[model samples]
Target: MVLRRIFPAMYTAKDSEPANSKNGTLYLLRCVFFMGVRKPPKRYFLAYCLWSFALNLCSTFYQPIGFMTGYVIHLSEFSPGEFLTSLQVAFNAWSCSTKVLIVWYLVNRFDDANEILDEMDKRITQDSERKRIHEACSLSNRIFFFFMSVYMMYATNTFLSAIFIGRPPYQNYYPFLDWRSSKWHLALQAGLEYFAMCGACFQDVCVDCYPVNYILVLRAHMQIFAERLRQLGSDPHESEEERYEKLVQCIQDHKTILRFCDSLRPVISGTIFVQFLVVGLVLGFTLINIVMFANLGSAIAALSFMSAVLLETTPFCILCNYLTEDCNQLADALFESNWIDYSKRYKNALRHFLHNLQQPITFMAMNVFTISVGTNISVTKFSFSVFTLVKQMNIAEKLSKTEEEVENLY
Candidate 1:
C-alpha cells in the first residue's frame, strides 16, 4: 500500500492530452499525434505548427533583410527617423527569430518537456494534493489565457490593419517586387501574408506561456512535497519499519523532483533566456523611442508596446521567483516532521535529508543567469543603461557635427 502510494500506476491512457499539464500553454500541439501521444485526429494542428514555424522563419529574415536593402540602395535618401522605424521592425523580427528558435527547441525537446507533467501526475496522487495541483493549474491557466488573449488581439489588430485598413505591418518586406502591376499577384501575396500571420500568432503564444506554466507546475509540486515532509512520522499506528520505508520513499521523491528540475532546465533555459534578451532589447528601444519621438501618436504607441511587453514577460519573472521561495521553505517543512519523537536511526536519516535540502533547487538559465525576478530585474536595468548610452551618443554626435560645421565656416 505504501509503495502504491509512493509510485503512481505507471499507466497513461493512450489518448491522454499531450500536456496533461491542464494549462493552455502548448495549445499548439493539441491537434494530432504529437511527439508520441495520440490526440484528436485533426492533423491541421501539427500542420499549423509547421506552417507557423516556416513563415516565422521567413519573417525573421524578411525584417532585417528589407531594412538592410533600403540602407544599401537608398543610403543617400535614407532618413534617420525612417531608418529608426525600420530598425524597430528589424528588432521585432529579431524577436521572431528567437521565438522561432524557442519553438524549434520545444518541438525538438517535446518528450523531455512532457516529463514535467509526467512527474506531476505520478506524484500528485492523493485526492487533496490533486485538488491543490488542479487549483494551481487553474490559476496559471487563467493568467496564460490572459496573455494569449492579449497577443491574439494584437494579431487580430494587425490582420485588420493589413486587410481592411490597407496598412501591412511588415510593409516593403518584399522590396523591389512590384505588387501593383497585377491585382491577382497582390491578392495572392496578401493571402500568403495572412498564412504567415497565423504561424507567428501560434508560435508566440506557445513560447510565451509554456515556460511560465512549467515554473508554476514545479512550484505546486514543491508545495506538495513540503506538505509531505511536514507529515512524516506523524502516524502513531504505523510500525517502525513502515515509518522507515516512508522516510526512504520521501528521499526518493526528493530525488525525482530534482531530476524533474534537471529535465526542465535544458528545456526552458534557451527559451526563457532568448525570451528575456529579446524583450529586454525591445523594451530598451521602446524607451528610447518615447524620448526620441515627441509626437503624441508615437508616445502612445511606445507606451502600449511597453505595456504589452510587461504583460507577457512579468508572469514568468514573478512565478519563477516564487519557485525559489518554495525551495527555501522545504527545510522548514522537514523540521515540521515529527522526527523528535522517532528513533535515533530515523532521526539521523531525516538529518541527512535536511542537509540535502540546504542547497535548494533553483532553475538557472544556461546555468548562468538564475531564473528569478532578480535576473529579470537585471534585464530591465540593463535596458535602461543601454537607453541612456544611446541617448548620450546621439546628443554627442549632433554636437560633434555642429562643431565640425563651425570650423568649416571659420
Candidate 2:
C-alpha cells in the first residue's frame, strides 16, 4: 500500500489508467513521454528521435573537439588538471548518452515491464505475510527516493556552478566548440543542456529503479514461498494429496519468478555493462582532477560528478547482490521445508526444484560480467589504481623539472 502510494503508476495493475493517476519524477516523465501509447504517435516518436539524435551527437563530438582544440592545438598551454577535468566531463556526457540509448531501446517494452510489476504486486498482496512484504517494499521505495533526491540536489548544484561560477561569459561549459556571441544565445544553449541532462537523468533513474523494484518484489514472494513450503506438513489435518498439490503450486510459483527475472535481464544487461565501463573511467578521471585541481569550483564539480557516478553504480550493485543472494537461498529454503513427510513423488519434485535453483539466477551486464557487490569492489579498486598511477606520473614529471632546474643553477 505504501509502495502504491509512492509509485501508483509503477505499482498499479491497470495500463488504461491515466498517467496523472500517479505523481513522481519518473511517473511524470512516463505520462509526458512514454505512457499509454503501444505505438507512440508519429509526432511523439519523431520528437524523441530528434532529441536523442541531438543528445548523442553532442556526446559524440564534445570530447573530440575538446581534445583537438585544447590538447592538440594548444598542447603547451593545456594544464594537466584542465585536461583531466575536460576528459571527465566528456565521459560524463557520454555516460548520459548511453543511458538515453538504453532507455530508448527498452521504452517499447514498457508494457511488459509493467505486467511483470503487476504480477509481482498481485502475488505479494495475496501472500499470507503481506504486511511484512508491504513494509519491506515501502522501506525500499523510501531509501531509493531519498537517494534520488540527494542526487538531484547534487546535480543542480553542479549545473549552477558550471553555468554561473565556472565558465566565462560567451564561453559555455558544454563540450561544444561553438561560440555563443550574446547573453541570450548562451542562455538558450544552457537551457538546452539542462533539458537534455534532465532527460538523461530521468531515464537512467527510471530504468534502474524498475528492475530494483521488481527484484524487491520477487524477493518478498520467494520468502513467502519458502515459508509456505516449510508449513506444508505442519497442518496434520491436510491429506498427503493436498500437501502434494501445494508443493506443485510452489514449484509453479518458483518457475514464474525465474521467468520474470529472465525476461527482465535483457532489458537491463547492456545498460548495466555500459554503466560499469563508463563509471570506471569517470571515477578515475574525476579523482585525478580533484587531486590535481586545488580551486574550489573544480573541487565542487569533481565531487559532484563523483557522487553522481557512485550513486548510479552503487545501488544497482547492492540490489543485484541482494537479488543473487535471495535466489541462491532458494535451495536452502526448500531443504528446510517439511519435505520429508511428503510422499516420494512430492520429494522428487522438491529435489528437482532445488536442482533448478542451484543454477545461479543472476543479472549479467551484457552477459559478460555479473552484476554484484564483488564487481563493484573490483571496479573501485581498478579506478583507484588508475588514479594512483596518474598521480605518480604527475609527481615524477614535476620532480624531473626540478632536477633540471637544479642542474642549470649548478
Candidate 3:
C-alpha cells in the first residue's frame, strides 16, 4: 500500500514468469563442480591469517600515536607526563578493534572479495577491448593476495618499530610505572601511528567496497535492459492488445530480474548494517572513554578524525540507498501511461541512466576506498597519491560530458 501511494505511476500487470531453468541448472552445476577445487594453498592462507594477526597487533601496539600526535599538534609541544596513561588505553583499544576488523575481513574475505570483484569487473567492462573477463576473474585472487601480503607485512613491521620506541610514553604518563624513556620515542611513535592508521583504513576500504560496487553495476544493467525492452514496442497508435502484450512481456522480465535482485538484497543490506553498527559502537566507546580520561586536545583530534572517517564513508551508504531506490524507480517507470509511446525513447534513456549510475557508485565504493587507504596508511608518500587520484577523478569527471550526456539522453 505504501509503495502504491508513493509510486502511483508504477502499477503494472502482475508478472509470473518461470525462472530461467537453464541458468538455474547451470548455476547449480558450476557451484558443485567448483566446490571440488581444493581450498586456496595452505601456505597462502596461513600467510593471510598471520598477516591479519600482525595487523591487529601493530594497530593495537601503536594505537596511542593518533592521540599523541593530536595532542602534540594541538599543544605544539610534547608532554609525556600528562597523556601517557590515556594514550596507553587508547592504543590498546585501537589495537583490539583493528585486530577484530582484520580477523573479520580475513574470515569473511569481504575485503578481498571487493578488490577482486572490482578488478574483475573493470577488466570485463573497461578493458573489454583487450582481455576476457574469464581471464580477469582467474587472475583477481592472485593479484589481491599478493597485494595484501606486501601491504600487511610492511604495515605490521612499521607499527611494531613505532611501538618499541614509543612504549615509554605510557610509562612517562604514570611516574609510578618507574620506567625511563627518551622524548624522541614519543615523537617517533606519534608520527608512526598517524601513518599506520591511514594504511589500515585505506586497505580495509579497498578490500570491502569494490565488490559491492560491482553488484550495483549488475543491478543497473538489468534495469536498463528491462527499460530497453519496454521501449521496443512503445507506440501511441498501437491497439490495446498489442500494448498489453508488450507490457506483459516487459513485466515478466522485470519480475525475473527483480526476484534475483530481491534475493541478493538481504546479503548486501545485512552486511552494510552490521558494519555500521560495529563501527558506531566502537567509535561511541572510544568517545566516552576519551571524555572520561583524556584532556581536550587529544580527545578532540581523535573524535574529529573518527568523524571524518565516518563522513568519508557517507558516499558508500548513500550508494546503497540509491541502489534500492533504483529498483523501485524502474518499477514505477514500468507503469507510466504515457510511457506507451516509442517516441519517448525510454530504452535509450535507461541505458544512459544505468551507465551513469555505475560511475559514482564505482568511484565511491572502489576508487575512494583505495585512495583513502593510500592516504591514511602512507602519509609521507601515498597520502598525496590518494588525494591526487581523488582530485583528478573528481575534476576530470566534472569536465567530461559523460554524465551530462547520460542525463540528457535519459
Top candidate when judged by TM-score against the true structure: 2
State the lDDT of candidate 2 residue by residue for 244-353, as single tens digits: 88778777777777777776677678667777787777888888767765268667766866776787667778877776677677777778777776688888888887
The residue pairs found clashing in candidate 3 are: 60-95, 111-207, 114-211, 198-376, 198-377, 199-376, 199-377, 202-373, 234-342
Q: Is candidate 1 or candidate 2 better by TM-score?
A: 2
Q: 2 or 3: which has the higher lDDT?
A: 2
Computed on alpha carbons, the lDDT of every model, listed in order, comes to 0.61, 0.60, 0.39
Give the TM-score of each candidate. Answer: 0.76, 0.77, 0.39
Q: Write the per-residue lDDT of candidate 1 for residues 1-410, one digit (tens) a residue.
A: 67434422212212222325544234434421232223323657677567544664555445456556655765433233334434554565566557656555555455565665676567666666765665566556555656656765654544454455333333444544544557665665555555554455445656666667666666777888899889888899999989999889889888877776776567577766666676677777767666764245445545555665666567777887677678779988998888887899999998999999877666666667887787788786777987888887885356446556756776
Rank order (by TM-score, best first): 2, 1, 3
lDDT of 3 at 208: 37
Task: Give stretches of model 3 more than 4 Å off.
Answer: 1-46, 56-199, 206-212, 215-219, 235-271, 274-308, 311-313, 336-410
Per-residue lDDT, model 3, residue 227, is 53
Compared with the true structure, what per-residue lDDT tens digits does model 3 show for residues 104-223? 434333333333333323322222222222222223333333333444443344344435544432222221222224556555544445454544544443333333333433443444
TM-score of model 2 (CA atoms): 0.77
* Local lDDT at 110 for model 2: 45
Instruction: Point to the candidate with the largest lDDT.
Output: 1
Clashing pairs in 2: none
Tell me how far the alpha carbon of residue 402 in candidate 2 is from the true structure, in angstroms, after superposition: 15
Question: Which pairs, if any, clash in model 1?
Answer: 52-199
